[model samples]
Each structure stands twice: as structure tokens, then as C-alpha cells.
Target chain A: MSEWWSVVETARRIADGEVTAFRVVEDMLVRITRVDRDLGAYLEIDGDGARTAANEIDRKRKAGEKLGPLAGVPIALKDNLVTKGIVTTAGSKILAGWVPPYEGTAVEKLRAAGAVILGKTNLDEFGMGSSTERSAFKKTKNPWDSSRVPGGSSGGSAAAVAAGLCAASLGTDTGGSIRQPAAFSGVVGIKPTYGRVSRWGVVAFASSLDQVGPLARTVGDAALILQTICGHDPRDATSLDVPVPDFSAALAAGARGLRVGLPKEYFAGELEEHVRAALDRTIAALRDQGAEIVEVSLPHTHLALPAYYIVAPAEASSNLARYDGIRYGLRVEAPDLLTQYSKTRGAGFGPEVKRRIMLGTYALRSGYYDAYYKKAQQIRTLIKRDFDAAFESCDVLLTPTTPTTAFRFGAKATPLDMYLADVFTLSCNLAGLPGMSVPCGLTPEGLPVGAQLLGKPLDEVTLLRAGAAIEAAVGLGDRRPGGFA
Target chain B: MPTLTRKEVEEIALLARLHLESDELERMQSELGVILDHFGTIAAIDATGIPAMTHAVAMDHAGPFVSLGVLRPDEPQPSLPVDEALRGTPKRDGDLIVVPAIIPGAKE
Candidate 1:
């Protein structure tokens, strides 16, 4: 069996009895042991649990029972997605050994679809930072370049998929967590429309902006995973009851007769040369396939970063208030309850998490609410309006995912410099639109460049169609990191 | 650019229920000031008559992605067992989570 089998093929072969699920799981476990030591992509590896689950799949197949769509597929979840019995840290010291009593809605869906849970992948503490360097345990390095960071806070999931650690992994996006990391790691990542997937039991970051999605080596694999996880759940109030169209079916629809818009504001900024070239290549590819490329304007793009900083942190501050050490996770004792709350939180959270909590608290404070929080919300309205207007003329907007490819560790010195890394990708989250990043090409240095596709709300089908086209055109076939391969 | 004072940083930290060390507080004052300064640009935009967007979904009653505020029917569903829920707590006394006294000068 090839080490780099796509999720779709892996499932098909296992279901058809061409390969035993036990053998597939064992191969992935061995590969992870060999590769993940240097990459640090996983926080936990459930070898025993995975083997037990795989054996069940094989048993069911032998019993002549119909298998689920994702039968025998090994998948990883970002640590923030709580698993019933596994330790889920969210890469924070506070929840270091905390085991959730119940699994999240998405995890439940994946298990029901017969995907074996590989284990939890590392992420920035509470999904706060753009790079996984903020993870309290260990920094996850980019698979492409050991010196560089896997774009985070979904860095582990992206890197794992890129290095073939697991077939596909789930990642959460607040601002650009999923897509940015996927871009840096040269994998396909999609942040489905905000309400597309239920967030029940997933650790909350920024309540309004957070959405769970998939990262995979191929767009079809991503679509398949997405198809399994998405649907309305009564447990999460924000989940949309809208019908989920067949995403995999839409991929074959192609880019023909589609109006692919180039948002002028996205191109107006100083993008690295390689990123610009990738964008140009994608535009040309889609045009060749009869997609009408048009220049569109999302005028409020410049304000997106600033607004996102305010809105996301503010929501994070509130959502993260549950971790006070009294109920679960790490507890730093004090003489009084109030002091205990302070001490426990301060000790449990890392620097970046503290910085965001402080910023968020200050923004929501009495006199400053109208100035910082409310004003940012108004700007968010404008940002959403920008997309609303642009979508009127286009099927999807195409742009560079990040300003540059993966950067070396410690490259972004200050907090604000690190925040700027997400400038190009923040608007999608603010507007609650579905956005995807597909590896477009490699730079002169062989670093991967990602082209982002932003679609209308609940329009992931269009994004998938366009992404599959880009992946086909830029045939960086079965690309793997040299040393790992 | 609004520079945050040391006292303001302390106050915010206290409000956030995060006990920062003296050195951490000093660092936060400088770093958060720079971020707040960057955020100052958003204040200059003319947002008169604009409604604050607390959520991303539009309030339209009719559309493909319409807002349905309907909640699930209230019913008794199976919840985690008592021991299961309390298992992860750092300090627990039987079925209850143990914590410092809420009232000042109270005995442990």
C-alpha cells in the first residue's frame, strides 16, 4: 500500500476488502511513529484505540453488513474538538490532562461514518495564534521546511496531512486558522460556512466566528469528510437547518461558465512575489476552462484585520471564562475564590492567550465598549456588506491565502506582526462565508503557495468545484516533504 | 494611538481574572498599547446609522440561509453520570467541586 493514499481511496480499498482495516491502521501508526517525531504534528496518538476501531470495521465487513462512506478511514481531530475519553488540551496547559466526558457533534458524526479516530493534533493554545508556536506543549514545524512554522492554529492538522501522518484531519477556523495552515503546509483546507457544521462540544474560542472544517491532501477527500460532518444539530443553536448539497458531486461540475471574481482590494496590498504568481496562475487556469474572470471590489478589506482583532478576542474573552479551575483542568489554589480564579487562569493560560484575554476584557469594559467593541462590530457589518455586494456579480472571489509562504520560527517578533500574517484571510470569517485554500504552485525555493477561494454563504460546492480545478491545473502530484518521504 | 497605563493594564487583568506577575504586567502594557493603537484606526470610520453586527447571518426572514431561531423541545435527555462529569475536576468532594470559600473570612 502507498504511504500517501488519499482518504477516498483508502476507504474504497478497505470497504472492498482489497486491504484489511487493521493493516491500514497499522501502516498509518508506523508512518506516524517514523515521521511525527521531527514534525511534532500530533499531540496524542491513539494506536490502541485506532487498532480496536479498525478491527471492528473488518469484523463488520466480514459479517456482510453495509459499511459507512468513511469506513476504515483514519482521521485526526484538532485538540480543541473534545473526544469522550481522550485527553483534549486545546494546546493549553489549563486543560493538560482533562478528558471530556462526551464527544463533540462532529466527532460523533465521524465515528458514525466509520472513520477511526487517530488522536488529537496540536494547535495554538485556545486557537489564539497564527502559528502553532503558542502551543503550550511543543511547536509543530512545517513539513515542507523544518525551520519554518506550519501555519497555525491548525498547524498540526495541516502538517499531519501534508506529511501523510493521517489521511485527513479536522481543524477549526476563527480568523484564518484552518486555511492559513493548509496554505503553509501545502494541503487543502476549507472553513465551511459558519452555520454549516454544528459546534456542540467543541471548545469555544470566538463563539460567532469559529467553524470546524477539514484539512486533506486532496480536495475530494476534504469534500468527503465535510459531507460526513455537516448538518443541523439541535444541540447547537447557530447550526443552519439548510439542506447540505452533495459537495463531492459538485466537484465534477468544473469551473465552466463560472464567474470567478478578483477582489481588487485583495490584490491592492503588497503580496509576496511568489503568492502573486500563484494567483495569476490560478486565474489563467480557470479562464482556460471557460471561467469568466472579473475584477470585483470588496472596498472594506483594509479594515478587516483590525475589526477581526477586536471582535474575535472580545468573543474569546467571554467564551473562555468557563475555565476557572473550580470544575475541571488545572487549578491553582488561593485563599479566596476570586484569587483562585485569577491565579488558576493566569497559571493555566500561556502568554498569547493572556494577551488576548486582557485585550478582550479591556475592549468590553464600560467606557470603552462603544469605542472598541461596538465600532468593530459596525466595521464587521461593512465587511459583510462588501462580500454581499461582490457576490452579486460573482460565483467566488479568488486571492492569495497568505501574504507569503511559511516563515521561519521567531520571524514574527511582536504580537501585532504575527497578527498581520492573517490580514488576507480574516474577512471571510467576519462575514461567515465559506473559504478554502488549495496549493496552487511551489515558489522558487520550493515552498508551497496557496490560492484562497471565498464563496457566498453556504456555497462550499462552488468553492470545491473551483478548488478541484486549481488542484488539477497545478499538478503538484502526490507531493511529499523530501526527508519524510 | 491610545497608550494603556500600567494601572489600566492591572485593572483589565484583574477584571479578566488573570493574575499576572509584575514583569508580565509591564510587558502587557507595552504590547497591548501597540495593538490598541493599531485598533485605533477602526474608530475613525464613519459608522453612523450602522447596526452592530453581533452575528454574521443576516436577519432576513426569507432566503436560502434564513434565520430560524427555533430551539429544540425541552426534554430530559441522558446526561453524563455524576462521577463521569466530576472525573476531570482538579479538586472534588464527592459529587461537588471543591473551591475556596466565596465569602471572606469563611473557614475552609
Candidate 2:
């Protein structure tokens, strides 16, 4: 019943009959009752749904039937993921009353593996903004300091995991959504290589950049969740046919004989002093563990934010066009079809979503396509080329996850300023590389700092290996976000 | 930097089918201009000979990740049932999803 138990640890106890699935589910509900009111991590609490699932798992265990890998583990899901009979809001009021017809591929896999669905967590509306403030619903607070923001659009998932509200959670990283929040909240989160996991039933943000991954208190738990979700799905056209590796095996590999690269450009820029110090310490720890630390430069890193804004919005503009009043979700009553479309969208979407839609419309306008959208795609190629070249010199690359630790809720006044918070993590999505954020150390202010690891395509194993080594060296166990310790 | 004027912003909003309030219109103009100006950095990059990459990772049949050739036979597949599809519709009648009528002579 301890929140400190990693997903693997919880699963083992369940397998050995040390804890019944029902009891674990009950304990998780009790914890949520006591803690989640202050955090606002979960937008909806599905105690009944989770309990029913848990009871079924317990019944199977009692009947001498084998359980799945994640037996009885309660996991939080980002609101964007479609869950059968559960409200999937995507943190927007537009879809306030909509319950998806079915579940997402990742959610289905988790259910099959015996993970209980606790509830849907909050996010920036349609995953547009870095801070969860852009959510049409309530903003999720950082567990470390409620005044500070949990880096987001996956803010709720990160906060939930950080607060020990769930054993682990699933978050979709479209533009550093998962990693930056995980960094701020002091959890391990990964955005697997593009197409490593299916994007079948998840609400599309930026189809090309969106990736569903896990947020966990420990590296092993992150790997466990990632393992369960990775593989091919015909439903997603871009899903890879690659084999899902046994990620747990990589944890035992450690960091020895691995060459970890430090991208020079990542160190440069307006990175906060505490973040840099933490990065330096993380590098030293990895070097001490016999991993060769090399200096590499991704020269095109500076262009990531610009290219990403253009590319993601363009995709979002198209993907979100489906919300015309005729189908599911909120609709405004208007005399004409056009007016209904306008009113519904304008009233439903938040300011950030509107801004992006306008920007994307401009970018893809009749005459402006070549100047913006096409150019951004070309820039994406250059960004990928930079990562491709850097990987040749090192097995993995490391950098600070965010330029600064979590700031106050209203710290970023302008939309452009908020966009800058994602500068460090955006390049990975642009390049379609697998990357992760593992807590390397804490800032002097007691806020957590995450050091990111970037790996070659389909090479998450090396990143996890390095992450486990660094997690052990830094000992993420000491600092408690809200109440776990 | 290619800045947007109010007229241009209105036109863009029209294209996006979002009816911004008057104040929201003004705010959108300023905010979008700033974002587009910021995005000028990408266009400045000399991408003369580089082909545009629509997907950051190649999903082509020859690509390492999708090397197995992901072309599934295009046979009919089971999809969401009609009742399930219509379940969340805001307005519906007899399984036909409802919407505001097309304005007469209001050609899009």
C-alpha cells in the first residue's frame, strides 16, 4: 500500500499474494481522497471503475489464474487518452461531455496488463501550452511548491506521479509535454522514439510529434510502462513494426562502456544557474560510473522552437477541424453551419489554442505555405540531421530538461515567453528521437531538476540504462515532492 | 518579419472558422504577429537543397523502425458501432447526427 513502491515492486507483491489487487485499489482511492484535493491532478476520479477492474483482477488471482505484468497497479492517464465509458476531456471544455466510444491503444494495453485506471489527469487544452494554465479546466499545481507551475501540458500526470497519487501514469509528449513536467515534478518520464508506441486512439495534437509514454517515480517503473505500450498497431498509420524490447533487461545493463554526449548548444543559452550546476553534477556522476562523456553539438538546436510552433500548429489546425458541431462534443446553437462552427470553436477553444490556429492558418494560407510550413519542414530535417550526426560520436546525449526549474503559475506573462520553457525538450520531438527526463538533482530552492537523455532512433534501451545508473548515483529517493517521504 | 495587420488577422480567423470577439480579434492580431515574427528564425535557415521532412522519423518501408513493411491488407475492418459513434453527439435524431442547417444561399 506504500506509494513508494515502484510499479515493478507493486506487481511482484501482487504476484506473490503479498497484497490483494482489491486492497491496493482501496489504498490508492484512500490516498487520492486524502491528497488529490490539494493537487488538482485528477480532473475525474473513477473509483468505481478502478475498483471493478481491481475486483476482477483479485477474482482471477483467487481462482489460480495468472495475472498480467501490472497486476493491481493504479495508474493515472492524461485526459487526452480515450478511455471507454470514461470522460476524455483533453483538458478542454469543448469535449466536456464526450465519452469516447473506445479506449486508446496504450490504455487497452495497460488494462490488459492489469493496470487499474484511476482517472484522467488535467492538461493544457488540446496540449497547446507548456503550463497547464491553458487548460479550459483547472490548472494543476506543482507538488514541490503549489505556487510554482508543474511544467506541462502533461502537468497533471507528472504532478500525480510526483505526489504519489498513482504508481505511474501515461502522458503524450507532443512538444516536450511529458519530460519538462516530469522534470519539474521530479519523476522519470520518457517520450519513446516516434512510432515506437501507437497513437491509435489518443487525441491528436501534432500527429507527427505526439508520442505516448510513461511518467513514473522510478526509472524501472517508467521502463515497465513503456514496455507494456510499445509495438505496432495497424490503426496508426505511422506506427512502427519494430519489436518491443524487454525494457527491464536494460536496467541491469547500467552505464558502463556507454558514451554519453553533452550537446554544447544545450549548455549554452539562458539556462538557469541551478539547472546548469545540476547538469554538471549529473555529468560527473555518469563519468565516475565509467561512461565516456563526450562533447557534441547540435548546431540547429536554436531553430527547434520556431520550427516546432509552425509544424505543430499546422497539424493541430487540421486535426482539430473535426470538432465541427455536427459530431460529438460541445456545440453552439447558431442559425447557420458556418456560424455554428465559428461560435463553437471560438467559445470552446482557449486563447492559446486560438492563437495557434490562427498562426497555422496563416502558415498554410493559399500564398504562404512555401514560406512557412514547407520551410519549417525543411528545418525539421536539419534538426534531425543534427541529432543523427551527434549520435555517431556517442551512444547517448545528455542535457538539462528545462532552462529553469518550475516557476510560479503566472511567471510567463506572454505566450512567447511560455513557449521558451520548452526550448530544451522540443528538439527531440522535432527530430523524432527517443528522449527521457530523469531526476538528476534538485535546485537549491528544493525544486527538482531533471537531466535529459537523448538516444538514437529505436535506442531507448541505452537511454534507460544511463538513466537507471544516474538515478542510482543521484539517489532520487531523498527528495519528496508532496507526501511520499 | 512578416507582420499581420488587423485585416489579415480577420481573414486568417475566417479561414480557421473561429469567431473571435472584437477584443479577442485585436489580441489575436498582436499575439499572432509576435509568434510569427519569432518563427522567422526557421525561414532564415539556408534550407536550399534540403527536401522537406513531413515526418521527423522516416516511416517508409525501407526505414529501420518500419522495416517490416507496414502495409496491411486493405480488407474491411470492424469499426465503432453506429450507436457508439452517435453516443456522444450533442444533437442527434435516428442515428443521424444533427447540426445547424446550412444557411440558404450562404455558400461557404
Candidate 3:
């Protein structure tokens, strides 16, 4: 099997009897065993379980039964997404031993589509930080450069797909968790418009902004997983009731005559020379393919990061209040009742979680509520307005997914420095807009760089179309990271 | 600037039911102070009369639609037993649940 055969392609091969699902699963396990030790992409690997499921899929295929798009494919789930009978810790010690009785909505969808759950990948404790360093268990290293970060809180999922450990993985994007990591890791990721994918089973970061997305080696693979997962779920009240389009079909439409708006502000300030050059090359490639590139301005782009910090943490502070060591998590021994609450939480939660809780608690506090959290929401409207106006002039927007390529581990020590990494990707989440990150090029150091495509709400087809055009133009998906097999 | 002292940090920690070590507390205090100071960037921006939007869709949940069974209609549902509910509880006095002695007036 070729290393670059996406999950969709592998499924077709299995269906055609050219290769069995067992062979694909075994091959993936062998690769993971060979590569994941150095990558730190997976927190837990379900080798035996995956093999069992794959064997079943192969049996069904031999029986001449129809299969799902992801049938017999091995896919990783972000640790935050609860999996039945698996240790679903959101990369935090707090939920270290918590095995959920029920699986998450998206995981259920994947199971319905016959996807073998490969394992759970590491993430920020409750999806907090941009760097996977915030994970209490382990830091996921970048596939391109081992010393650099793979981006987070879905860093593990991105790294797994990038390093070829898994065919594809699910990552929750709450303010760039999915897209930024995809950018840094040199893979494709899509955070569907808010509510397009159900959030019922995923651990909440910020309820309003979070969405489960796919991280894959290619945009088409990402879209295949997305089409399977994007639909209304009675379990999630906020889940969108939009029709799920055949994203893989849309990807072949190409980028001809598409009005791609390049937000001017995203190109300036903190954009590395390499990133700017790569973005320019990507835009030029699209232009050559008959795409109409226009310089459009999202005037309120600068306020996105600040507004995100306020609103996300405030919502996080509320959503995370569920984990009091009283529901499903680690429990520290203490003498008194009160002491138990204090000790369990203090010992279990990582520093980043505590920081966010504190920030959120303060933001939602009564005396200052209107001044901070409330005002941030108002600005969120203005930010959405900026995108709404820009979309009127163009079908979609284009920008660098991240300002720079992957940075070395511990490179961004301060909080704000790491927060700045999401400057480009956060607004999409804030506006409930669909967005994608596709590999554009590599830095001079050989680290990967990615360009982002933003589309109108519930218009993932446009996002996928532009992504496919760029993916074909660059042909970066077939290229593995340096020194890989 | 939002001046967060060691006392305020201690208070917030207590409210959140977190017991921090002395060094951890001090470190958090300093970090929180720096972050709170940065909030001035947002505070400096003029948002004079804009209405705050709690939800992106801005649906009124407290209205008559709630009574029409749209907003979290109450329905009796099967759940785990008392033993199962207490299974994850860190502090359980036999069948009775226990919590911290939160001083009501102290928080205010």
C-alpha cells in the first residue's frame, strides 16, 4: 500500500478486493509502531480493537455488502471526544481514569460509517492552549521538525495524520485548535461552520465556538470524514439542520472564476517572510487556475484574538464547571469534604486549565460583566459583520492559516505569545464560519506552512472546492515530511 | 490595570475550590496580574452603546417559546441509581453527598 493512499482511497481498494481491510489496518499499526514513538501523536493505541473491527469489515466486503465511505479505515479520535469503555481524558490528569459509558455523537457517526477507532490522540487539557505543551500527559512533536510544536489543542491529531500514523483524525476547533495545528503539521484540516458537526460527545471548551473537524493528509479525505459527520443531531441542541453536501464531489469542481478575497490585514504584522512568500505563491497558483483574487479588508480582524480570549474562556469557565471530581474524573484523597474538592481539582487540573478558569470566572463576574465579557460579545458581532460584508464582495476568503511555521518546543512560553498564533484562525470560529487549512509550502527550515480558506456559514462546499484546487496546484499531500519513509 | 493581589488570588482559588501550593499560588498571582493588565487592550476600545450578545443566534430562551416545549422542556428520564451517582463523588458520607463549607457572606 502506498503511504499516501488516503482513507477514502484505501476504502475503495478494500471494496475492490485488491486489498483487504485487515491488510490496511495491519499496515497502519506497523507504521504507527515504527513512527509514533518519535512523534508522541497518540496517547493510546487500540491495535487489537482496530484489527478486530477491520477483520469484520473485510468479512462484510467479502459477503458483497455495501459499505460506508470510511469503511475499514483506521481513524484517531481526539482524547476530548468520549469513547465508550476507553479512557477519554481530555489530555488532563483530572479525567485520567474516566471511561465514558457512552460514546460521543461524532464517534457514533464514525462507527455508523464503519470507521475503526484507531486510538485517542493527545490534546490540550480541555483544549486550552495553542501549543500541545499544555497537555498534562505529553507534548506532541511536529512531524516535519521534531523539536518544533505541531500546534494545539488538536496537535496530536494533526501530528498523527502528518506522520502517517493514522489515515485521518478528529480534532475540535475552538478558536483554531484544528486549523492552526493542521497548518503547523503540514496536513489538511477543516473546522466546519459552527453547529455543522454535533458537539454532544466532545468535551466542551467554549460551547459556542467549538466544532469537531477532520485532520487528514489531503483535503478530499478531510471532506469525506466531514460529510459523514456534518448533520443535525438531536443530542446537540445547537447542531445545524443543514443538508450535508457531497464534499468529495465538490472538490473536483476546481477554482475557476471563484472570487477569492485576500484579507489585507492578515498578510501584515507578525507574518513571517517565509509564510508571506508561500501564501503569495499559493494565491498566484490559484490565479493561474482562473481564480479571481481580490484584496478585501476585514477591518475588525485585529480585535478577534482579544474578543476570543474573553468569550471563549468565559464559556469555558462555565462548561468546565462540570468537572468537580464529582462526576467522572480523578479524585484526590483529603481529610474533610471541602478539602477533597480543593485537593482533587488542584491536583488534577493542569496550570493552563486553572488559568483559563480564573480568567473566565473574572470575566463573568457581576461588577465587571458588562465591561469585559459583554463587550467582547458585542465586538464579536462587529467581527462577524466584517466577514459578512467581505463575503458579499467575494464567494470566499483566503489567508495564511497561521502567521508562521511550526516553532520549537517551549518557544512560546508566555500565554499571549501563544494566543497570537490563532490571530488568523479565531475569527472563523467567532463568526460560526466554515474554514479549512491546506498545506501551501514549507519554510526554509523545511517545516510546513499552510494557507486557510474561509467560506460562508454552512457553505463547506465552497471551502472544499478552493482547497481541492490549491491541493492539486501544490501537490504537497503526496510529499512526506523530511526523513520519512 | 487589574491589580490582582495574593489575597484576591486566594479568594478566587477558594471560590473555584482549588487548593494551590504556596509557590503555585504566588506564580498564578503574578501571571494573573500580567494577564489582567493586558485586558486593558480591550477596555481601551470604545464600545459605548453596543448591546452585548450572549448567544450568536440571539434566541430569547426565557420567552413564551420555552413554554411551547422548544427550550429544554422538562421530561422525566431514566438515570443512574444513587450508588452510581455517588460512584464518582470524592466526598460521600455514606448515601448523603457532602460539599465544601462555602461561607455565603464571605464570597460577597
Task: Give per-residue CA lDDT, model 2, range A387-438, as digits (tens).
Answer: 8899889999999999999999899999999998999999999889999999
In model 3, where do residues sit more than 4 Å from their true spots?
A: B58-108
DockQ of each: 0.79, 0.76, 0.36
Deviation of model 1 at B38, angstroms: 0.5
Ten-residue segment with the worst summed lDDT in candidate 3 chain A? A327-336
Q: Largest lDDT belongs to which candidate? A: 1
**Stretches of candidate 1 exceeding 4 Å from the true structure:** B58-64
* DockQ, Cα level, model 1: 0.79
Task: Provide the lDDT at A60 for model 3.
Answer: 87
- In candidate 3, how many Å is residue B17 off? 1.8
Return the clash pairs for model 3, or none: none
Deviation from native of the Cα of residue A315 in model 1, angstroms: 0.7
lDDT of 1 by residue, B1-108 (tens): 689999999999989999999999999999999998997788788899997887776545554467766556788899889999899988877898778888888865
Model 2 TM-score, all chains together: 0.98
- Candidate with the greatest DockQ versus the true structure: 1
Candidate 3, TM-score vs. the true structure?
0.94
The candidate that wins on TM-score is 1
lDDT of 1 by residue, A1-485 (tens): 44589999999999889999899999999999988998999999989999999999999999999899999999999999999899999999999988889999999999999999999999999999888999999999998899999999999999999988899999999999999999999999999998889999789999889999999999999999999999988888888988999999998888899999999888888899988988898899999999999999998899999899999989899988999998898898889998999999999999999999998998899998998899999998898889999989999999999999999999999999999999988999998999999999899888999999999999999999999999999846766777677
